[model samples]
Target chain A: MSEKSPEELYAERVKRVLDVAALRVPDRVPVFGPYQLYPYTFAGVSFKDAMNDYALAREACHKFQDYFQPDLDFGPILAYPAPAMEMLDIKWFRWAGHGLGDHVMYQYIESENMTADEYDEFLYDPSHFMMSKWLPRSFPPLAGLAGWPAVRTFMWFGWTGGYVGLAAPEVQEALRNAAAAGEELGRWFDSIGQYADETKAKGNPQAYAGFDWPPFDIIGDTLRGTREILADMRRRPDKLHDALEIATKIFVEYGSGAAGAELPLCWIWMHKGTRNFMSDAQFGEFYWPYLRKGMLALIDQGIIPVVYCEADVESRLEHFADVPPGKVIYHVSTTDMVKAKSVLGGIATIAGNVPNVMLLSGTPDDVREYCKNLIDTVGKGGGFIMDAAVMLDEAKPENLKAMIDFTKEYGVYQ
Target chain B: MKEQLVSAIADMREEEALQLAQQMLDAGEDPQAVLDAGKEAMTVVGDRYEDGEYFLPELIIAGDMLKAIGDMVKPMLQAQASQTEPLGKIVLGTVAGDIHDLGKDVVGFMLDISNFEVHDLGVDVPPEKFIQAIQEVNPEVVGLSGFLTLAFDQMRVTIEAIKEAGLRDSVKIMIGGAIMDDSAAQYIGADAYGPDATAAVKLAKSWTGGK
Candidate 1:
């Protein structure tokens, strides 16, 4: 492995990810994860510091890459800008020292920023409603948006009076802070970009090729709270469907617009479609149609959609058969791996079942045993990517070291 | 007529359920009988949820339908004045430092439909608030809810505060949410943990000595 050139290693790593993504056998199973804020923890930097200090955040990524050296890298980890969150006074996220200790990981506050009664307004003009309604509600700094009707009036025949709102002292101060935050965020991204380059130079291909999500989840996760959306499902199924239609259009437009005609190995974060969240009937009615629309949108653009199901999705297995074979990948955490293999073996690549909880608490021997079982079973038909069930926030570094080590040694195909 | 009311609720016909409930009351049917029918409808809802015939929407709609019936029946029941003891009283909240409340809301709604008097403290509730609510309401069970892993510590802190306040022995403590499990329950010194809302209801029922 050490004899190979960096370019060769980069090509081989990308090939492993793409090969498994296409339901074909690579030389061995690829190991990757959605590691957010974890590298910061691994590098002994508080997430608060990492968010504010681009160098610290980049260093964390470098440290993690150097220590574990997995087949693929989830780049730019821990890029959340502290200044921006503080400037917005955002209620959506709780970073260290906000509501938690300096070392505690960031927590997303999922509340009802959008109530049930606002479906028509949101569906009619999602962009307008999001800017005027959703943003104002989610972020306190943006609450002054009511003072600026330029957004509501369609730029008001190109008038300059709308600038009056920004002249407000608080709004001006907020804008200044926001400009500073944007600069910090840009620097942070640049650091991540540099890290990505360094990882490639070292032969580790960045794993998160791109990101997308299911439409229903896009709304349910960010717009309306879970309870609100579920209640809306029964109370106003028609209005819910109407909103879903708009969301599908918006997601597809955004996904295609950002990626152009094709994207490489797009990661579709799947939530609220799993078995525990909904029944098969509801999954079909409310979740699947819109999800399929978005997935097909990406698939039509020749992008491989690697959908990472957030939780167990045993009952929703048969729905994957509707999608074209080898066009998509299913990544799961708690769903039965063998069942996933049986259901999606030929039609799509099946990745993951490694429990994050076990990694945090289990021994290296346990990690090796589990990886061997997964590679032997789900890895059998050459359509499996060995991965943890969820994003790796914090794990016993040795256990992760053991997992990739075991897979590389044992997961090779003849 | 009562059977029809049950069917309307069981079938998740919200408006129909409300109408049938009102009609039953207007026809001078016992208000207790109307409440019993509503409760039975929730039983069916719970059963369907477990059996996979229903989803969260069904549970929410049924809870709304029952609340509508409850609004009508509760007034008449007050006039009739039987003064029966409630099945149990539960004080619930998302633990301090965590704001996720979807699971807590589901559990609260389920307990409400099942006839448990519930006091929901909403999200980001400090341990002191749980202690204060416990003192004010003297509930049979205290439920700590959160989804973040950090809430595990908050649960332990809250349970410790309850114990420190000398109320631990008087009430059962149950922790639940997306991140909680039996081991979390044990780690936090909670009496039990509910994997989901249905399991929470069953745990509450068992603690209250109710069927």
Candidate 2:
């Protein structure tokens, strides 16, 4: 067995991915790379350092390829602009040395940034509400927004005292800083795009085209916060449903715009809709309908939606039956894979559930054993993409190496 | 009227609850009675949460309502009743590296309703702050909360800090949040693990012997 050329590797990888994606048994099961924050950790570069300097991040990516050489890589880590966040003095997220020590990772600060009584205002005009209300409250630097006139008044009438604030030195400084940060992030993303192209040229394929949010997560995570959103279900059910419907409509429109493109993949991050988060009835009423609608629309436009089911979704797998078979991929993180495969085997390609705790603390043998079982069971017929339960970060390199090695050998179809 | 107050709160009718509290106060009802009614309503809320009828939003709204009523009734109680004692004192935070706090807030609400003095250090609390809070609050128990995998290490360091400061023996240590199991609790040197907000209160009561 001589080394295959880059062209051969790329062809073989794409064919295998498309085969399992269609629930057809290809030559073997495809291995997925969940390398989220691990590349920086592996390169001995802190998350803050990498976020501040794209060169450090690019260096980590180079290190990532040298190690696992995974079949697919998620686009970029710390895509958020650290400099913009620093300039804005944003309190919603804390990076290294900002809240924790310099070596600690970044985290999002969850707060009831939007109050319960403000639902009507938000539902009426989301753009104006976000710019004037949510932005100022969530980002400290944008507190000047409260001084601006209603966005509707400005847009419709085109003359107001709001424009005066734009001339203030502090507001001007904030605007300048934000614009500079946007340019910085644009360059960063461009470099990452170039990196993706280079990796594709080297035979590793990119899996996702763009990212979107499930309607419930967009509401719960940013708009209402988790606790507030859940309470609205009982107290203000009508308002909550209205918000979900609007969110679904917006997502479908945005998602369809990217259809029939080169990537043709929509990554939907699923949160706050699983069994652990809601009751079966609550999930059915509040979550599934809106999300399914957006998914079906995306599918109608020739886009394959890959739903990343976070947390325990074992009991909620039945809700996915509405989508057409082989048009979706469900990447679940903490559910029973055996049960998931039993439920969703022919319906879609099932990925993930290798525990991150095992990857972080366990030995190479443990990693190999877990991958072996997943391949033998879920990889039996087809429609199984081997993945980690959580995004791989700070995992032992040897353990990750063992997982890839074991999957390549044991995942072969007889 | 008391039953109505409880029903209003348990049903999450905020305006109705406030009106009921005000009406009862004007009719010369004891402020302590009003406080008891609020606690009973929270008990119902907690029960609903465990039964899957309520979730974080319910808990948050209920907690907010209870605080509103408590603020109104507290001044009157402080002036009228001088001998009433709180159930217990506990210090809670979301640990050093993690900022997720939905579970922490729920646990704090449960403890607040149970008449415990809860000092929540908020999210992304460092180990030194835990040590500082333990020294200042002199709590009977300290809870380290986190939702990510890295929180395990933060929990361990916080517990170690308590031991180093000679406060480990004075306070019971517990850990809670997502991604936490018995093994994780044991690994972090916690005395016990609570899977939910209600269970956390139960564990705290057992440790304080219903003080």
**Alpha-carbon TM-score of each model against the true structure:** 0.85, 0.89
Instruction: Output DockQ, candidate 1.
Output: 0.37
**lDDT digits (tens) for residues A358-414 of candidate 2:** 777779998899998999888889989888776666678898888877888888898
- Model 1 lDDT at residue A179: 72
Instruction: Give a tens-digit lDDT track for model 2, residues B17-135.
Output: 99999899989899988988888898898888878787666777888888899788877775765434777899999987787877788789888877788999998898899999999
Worst 10 residues of 1 chain A by lDDT: A254-263
Candidate 2: segments with Cα more than 4 A from true spot? A77-79, A87-91, A111-121, A131-178, A261-263, B78-89, B114-117, B132-141, B163-172, B205-211
The number of the candidate with the highest DockQ is: 2
lDDT of each: 0.79, 0.79
- List candidate 1 segments past 4 Å from native: A115-117, A147-181, A257-263, B1-4, B19-34, B68-97, B111-146, B149-194, B202-211
What does candidate 1's lDDT look like per residue over A1-414, in tens digits?
Answer: 889999898888877777777777789987777776578778998877877777777778879887877877776554577776787788878888788767666777678877777887887677767766777777776675545444555465644665665577766654565577677667767777788788778887776557777888888888887767877777788988998888888777666643532127677788788766777878899999998988888788777777888777878889976788877888866678998888888898887867665676678998999999999888996988888776776678888889888889999988
Supply the TM-score for candidate 2: 0.89
